[model samples]
Target: MRTNLDFSPLFRSSIGFDRMLNALEAASRAETIDTWPPYDIAKTGENDYRIVMAVAGLSQDELAITQEQNMLIVAGQKANSDDVEYLHRGIAGRSFQRRFELADHVKVVGAGLVNGLLTIDLKREIPEEMKPRQIEIRTGQGMPKAETKQIEAKKQAA
Candidate 1:
């Protein structure tokens, strides 16, 4: 059973949160969740993250990773061979694509494939202007004095 949530109340009073609200609505509308090729997401540090995926029987050349804006896409294509016939096929060798939504300022630093496990590293780098800054407060004594100029009247009775 699927339940739909109404966000009309939030939309009326909120501002500049359309993207986050839209993401929530889309997630709720998804019918089936894909669980193939198990993966794990871990937080290595304050701004560092790692994603490990079990892509058995897939080589580096068969896998592709892409970063577009705030989305991370991972796709795998398995090459099929007809020369060998197997009576029992227990292993999965199929093409699959997965997408992950990334937050602002989050970027993928590196990726590697070893022993059928794909590892991807990510880091969140905030711009200097966007980071929190401290403001200095000054009292009246520290304020600069305003300059005043005196005007002389010209003698016209010569």
Candidate 2:
């Protein structure tokens, strides 16, 4: 006997979960989205990681880093004046949004801007019990039956 897995009818069912379905639909749409703001992710040490974003011309006052709902969102806006005239504006001093996928254990420690590089450090401190350990075993076997009695006898004998 053979069973046929028919998923076609399941797709036709109208559960009417429009919002949830829409959000999931948008998830697929997000797969094609990519923003080019060069960045470097480096693991400096055990449980320590750093994210360096190249945000030239963006001051510390202009940048904001926040964690919301498991997303590390780095957003910044260049301080501007509408009345300023630019004879030759080549450098990009515009707004930017950068998103990072953070693991469950990973967390943002702090952030700083140095030499046009915005560095955000993350750490994942696992508990002591969570760390791997070797289990030490003692098995002189059932206490070596005869040997056990001999030691007790020796203590008494002495």
RMSD of each: 4.8, 12.5
Q: State how far residue 88 of model 2 sits from its true place (Å).
A: 3.2
Query: Whose lDDT is greatest here?
Result: 1
lDDT of 2: 0.79
Each prediction's Cα lDDT score? Answer: 0.95, 0.79
> Clash number for every model?
0, 0
Q: What's each prediction's TM-score?
A: 0.88, 0.63
Residue-wise lDDT of candidate 1 within 90-150, one digit each (tens)? 9999999999989999999999999999999999999999999999989999989999988
lDDT of 1: 0.95
Clash pairs, model 1 backbone: none
